[model samples]
Target: MTVDRGVDVRDDSGFTLMELLVAMMLIGGVLLGLAAVQTSALVTTAQTRQRTLGTAVTNQVMEELRALPWNTLNKGLHASFASAAGGDPNVDGARLRPPVEPMIDEVLVTSTTQATDKAPLSGSGGTNVTATSNPEAPGIVFTSRSYVTRPAAGGESLALTVITTWRANQTADERHVLMRSTAYAPSGGCGDPNNQPYLGACQALFSASAGGTAPQTTITAAFGGETTDPEVDATTPILPGTDITVATMRGGQTGVGVTAQQSTAVESSALHAAGSLTAAGAPSASASTGGEAVENQASNDVGSEGAAPTDPSPVTSNGVAGSLAIDGGDLRMVITPGSGSQAKVSASTVTKCTAALPAGVPCAASDLASAVASTTTLSVGATNLQLVRVASSSITGWGARFAGVAGVAATGCSTVSGPGCVAAGASRSVGAVQLGSASWSGGAASSGLIQVTSYSDSTRVERGLSQRTAAPVTARSGSLRYWNGSAYTTVSITGSTSVTASTGTVTWTGGGYTVRATGQVAVTPVTDLASAPDPAGCTGEGCSISTETGTVSLSVHYRVEGPSGVSAFVTTTTLGAARAAAGFKAAPGA
Candidate 1:
């Protein structure tokens, strides 16, 4: 059939023109390597979400400078990153950032600027590097750097550093993002052994010494670390004549040292008088009589003899007469002149009597001679009667008498009581006197009486008296002193006494004395030290930097960038397309 058909060629079915231009250049080179691997996976997912939002904004600014207050941690970097219209340094998007300005670029590193690593983030070198502008991602851009170190001597701890740099679209080939971290400020706390600042914590030093002797005393605590031996809580021991008060440890939470107060002393005894007796003048008597009465001879003149007595007598003769009569049972009588003559006497149981005798010696002849033989003799005519002259008596009978002034011839009698008789005109008896057996011859008398002898005297006395008083004491809490050798002088208590802290003792009883107290410990000084900012390229040539006293070094740096369109590129890269040298060329053409 048409064998000649073999010469008719058939191969025009699609793709020619140089195979469609190499299939549109291999599908536009695999869509430009998938749009450069999706813009390098959106720039590596916006650089891993801006490095996790700049490490969460630098761990929230190192937990807000570790909650500040370790003497304010060098106070720096805040205040909205130091002005650029100040306010809004990422405003609440990354939270935690509020120390408001002290040093957005403070730096004071030492040890040769931390041995350099291009060290000028701000450690006294230069170049602060602030650049902030995020306000929660509006075009992103941030840079902050801080460094501080120079404390570590007695080592309380210090060393902080932070550096952050970021860039997202302000493209000058934009591609910077760095964030280094180091944090520590007021870490763990507690220090200030008097380095002159940072006041708080570390106290325990009390002291006392009143131990010269009485009640014994000595207290000491002193705390530097280890020496334990202090505990005298509700105390006691200052009694003998006491007044005690002790208090120092104040409130709670431990750490109490230096606070003191003390007191004690008082004493008394003396008063007495008693003994007595007194007496003077003892013993008494009284008696009286006169004369006349001699007419008793009427019994017929008792056997005769009447008118022969006219010389000075009314004797009418018959027997004993006139005188000697002690009645009331001291019986002693002898009065006879006839008609009723009497006789009854006795008073001499003689016990060695003597009050003077010998003048005619016959007042009963020596101790009343048995009271004249117990009298009773009467021989009238022969005059043999008895009882002869006796006187000196505190009255027993016939104590006072007088008569015989007619013919005047009786005299005598006077040894004690007298105002009358003793001769002179005669016949008189003053007080006690007795004479018996008639014998006054020309005076006609037989006895008289006058006597008084009594006496007594006594005395004794003793005395002593006193008055003046005050003694009262009490002590609580405590603070009373009188040591006065070098110090301590204040003691005044009486009656209501008071002191409060709990613990008491105070006794008084006149005055016996005792007191000495010394318990001292109270110290608190460090005046707080949070003011150290103003130094970061100061300008007047004084960026302040001279610190060393232990613990306080902080450095912080943070950076973030990722807002320029929230970034979106996954991946991309490609190259390779030149060849032509292996084939010949074509030029001429006529």
Candidate 2:
């Protein structure tokens, strides 16, 4: 034992008055280790949350760029396109406008004032400056810089890249994420022919190849941008935004517009109501997307959350109180490169391969080649879709007005009750007078245009105000019973819903939502009623269909999976008719 400062200490490691200080040092060291571990966890969590937000912001910026008229992305925004001298001088030397959203994340320390650097290139050979953004933030600001790659010498596409940077709070290191996208211009630029928004098809989804045998190596999941490793095909970036907007004007004319372009793609301005489309003056010119190195194919979905049940909605009026309004004007689908000598698709005898076509009816084809390889094809006008699908507890208004047979009222207005009368999903759907429901022949090839517009059974009906539920209680599923006069009958709508008495099961036997649109129990599958196939008025190659119309009011939702990548557009306009019976539901509280 050793004596030190009046206390006897046992071993050198043991504690005495002086040695006690050493023991305290050991505890302090352990605590420091623990604090370091805790700090690491907090840092990791913060980064993960910020990364998620950055990803969403990155995708949104790219989508906004794509949504604009394709031309603006090059000349209007980049300043390096169509100047004939390679780039515009007055503008910021061809660099893309950097994306900034103060509301999204931490505000940049130097927001109004910014520092400049050649936007970071995810790949090689990038040497352009003039674009500006906040590379540093006071706390955790996410600043993004963008760059646009004009199409290669024979290419018409425009590549967009966004690099989002954020400085980590713990470490002074700056973290970044890169995202990209591509877009095409519309056809028939009678106004700005050379400066059209899209030089190629707006929805091509591929990347430049490295002279390789296997091309999937450099493909992405959406319209072409930066080509990521194709092996991670499951991680394809999803382009965000609604589909395109097409509306018919007063003089039986239709137009589509993208506000970002600062111009209108008003197609079919002059359809020659008096005579032939080729007669005197028909706005001629269609953007032909024949050249494109299409991307790879994959088994993919747009992030499926399982199908949400269609909410209850009303089918409104066609504004025709009594007139047939059936003197349907002629809508010629003029395919620019069509064989004029051959019968126009509007007058062709093509097989009713409704199944293979947009219509889901099954048909057999004899000449698969002539059948698949048609003279005409579907243009952007025909392929755009406008959809709004959501499941909510709050609903207002109705789609169609229903009355009781033999003076009976449609008792379908019980909002929050038990299992509904109709089948599992929606069994009844009422639509306004539609001009685009035709059989397989080109005469009126209309189906699949408005594939699903339905509402479920368990919904209640209220006129002035929407109903509110205090809490969500499993949203009662399964068959139920309703009062059908004399005896309590398993609920059933005369033509739509039916129940098996022995088993409490409701089933939908009706032809689909669009079938019973107006006429009693009418289910002629809609192929292309509002729009036609070839705008130059030919039977579309059936690759897609255009929604042509003399006059009607409705919302359109168009989405397509092209070359493994997904792109969508949406437009809502009141046609010559009143507002569509589109129902709105207030989402439930968490």
Candidate 3:
């Protein structure tokens, strides 16, 4: 019997049961959407990572394969590095994908020779093995193998392909990446010196005369290779060219000089010739792009003849030994450096810089022909030894190493190259250097066949009628002068006739005088070679590594034989890392 209020009051505080249920459903739905988005993002990130890894693995391995020797590009005897392939990286410096390379672990490597995507011409099928890639891609695995297209008849051009395959844990689809290249066998796979990759320094070398006092010279460019002996036919011409005509030696039957002590030694060359010597200035080096290969050019060289220092313990043999001239000479195993045309050194022993270097840096191997006389410290000393890479893919340098006076304070240290170093001796510097096409050949029982050639465009002697008397008396009986690296050599001429000299042919007609000089070494391809004479070696497993030195040479050319697209020359790779594995594997890629 409470007093009746104006109206009955009611409280509507919280939400209704149905309202709460609807709100809870909305919140749960929002949370679920956020979780789904996060999951999708994570998956996308993982896929991206896998793609990136696959690309890296493909590229790195492709690069490694690209460095293989031309003949070494063939399929392996087995699907493993345990056995020697056609050519081995350790022996021939054929850089296939390194088994220990990062990101991808190879259980086995195989090569297949197929005209199409089918199996190999003759071989056991390739062994399948799971790949273990980087931990970053724990769920993915990669596998790789090489593909070589069967050469066309009479056209030994080979198409090379390095294919890499991969699959992820959750996906049914597999991805692939491939790298490809073409290789040509110059002489039916006998061997090609010019087709080699410069394993050390990318450069060309030529012999030069160290003329004058202590044979002072400044190198503007250089080339390097290993020297081995291989006997050749002594009576026939070894090479053909406009200037080369005869053989250097007239003794020794085929394969007569190969010795049991055949050993390989590093060959180092400074300049093509004294004529190629140029004073140091701004180096004119180059690097590679997508299409172009890498290169280097040196300049502003200053040097002089001097003694070898003791502290750095310079390399005494196979380099600028006292009186060994570093003149850029006109000689080479092949016309091209590394287009599978020729190979002087086994592997690309050196890889040069990405950009053009200044006056004082080293170049890369991709563009360089090679490096020689590699030593613990002497050839690559911190301050004493200075190397300059040339655009022609070689090295040009000057050494100021000089022995210290017995009692005086480094008497002979003054030179054009620079000053002396700590715990060093007196030295002399090279003042100038020149760059040009050049090469050199080693002498011995294992030397390869080479023809001495005389170049004419600028290296020899050639001039248009621009300076001669227009319609005047012919150059008949006119005197001629030519630069022989150190000085101008005057030569006698016969009137309106060609005179054959012991070394060359000199002609003087109504046109200017032409002096052609040539020399040659008649070498036979040795069957008892240290390395395999052919890429397919005797057993097709691989050539037995020579316990002695490996002898190799350039292909033989016969100028006297005439050009029928036929040559008597064959080349072989002889030296590099030589290793053996415990197990033997035999099978061509299928």
Which candidate ranks first by lDDT, i.e. highest? 3
Each model's TM-score, in the order given? Answer: 0.18, 0.25, 0.27
Tell me the TM-score of model 1. Answer: 0.18
Candidate 3, residue 82: Cα displacement in angstroms equals 16
What's the candidate order when arranged by decreasing lDDT? 3, 2, 1
Candidate 3 C-alpha lDDT tens digits along 1-590:
68865877799799989999999999999999999999999988987887787777766655554555553544432333324223332122233343333332222223544112122211233322224388998757876555444433425455555556677765567666655566554442232423552222111110111000111112111111113222334222223221221211000000000001011011112211111111222122111111111111221112323421111211211111111111112222211111111111111112211122111211111111222211110011111111111111122111111112111122111222111110111011111111111121121111111221210000000001111111111111223332233333344333222322211211111112111212111112211122332333122332222111111111211111122222233221111111111101111120
Q: Order the candidates by TM-score, highest first — what do you get?
A: 3, 2, 1
Which 10 successive residues of model 1 have the least lDDT summed? 208-217
lDDT of 1 at 376: 22
List RMSD in Å for every model shown: 60.1, 32.7, 29.7
- Name the regions of candidate 3 deviating beyond 4 angstroms: 1-11, 74-132, 151-156, 170-173, 184-590
lDDT, each prediction: 0.23, 0.25, 0.25
| Candidate 1 runs further than 4 Å off | 1-14, 17-22, 49-69, 74-142, 145-165, 171-189, 193-590
Q: Identify the leading candidate in terms of TM-score.
A: 3
Rate residue 511 of model 2 by lDDT. Answer: 20
- What lDDT score goes with residue 19 in model 3? 100
What is the C-alpha lDDT profile of model 2 across 389-422, one tens digit per residue? 1111111111111111110122221332211111
lDDT of 1: 0.23
What TM-score, to 2 decimals, does candidate 2 have?
Answer: 0.25
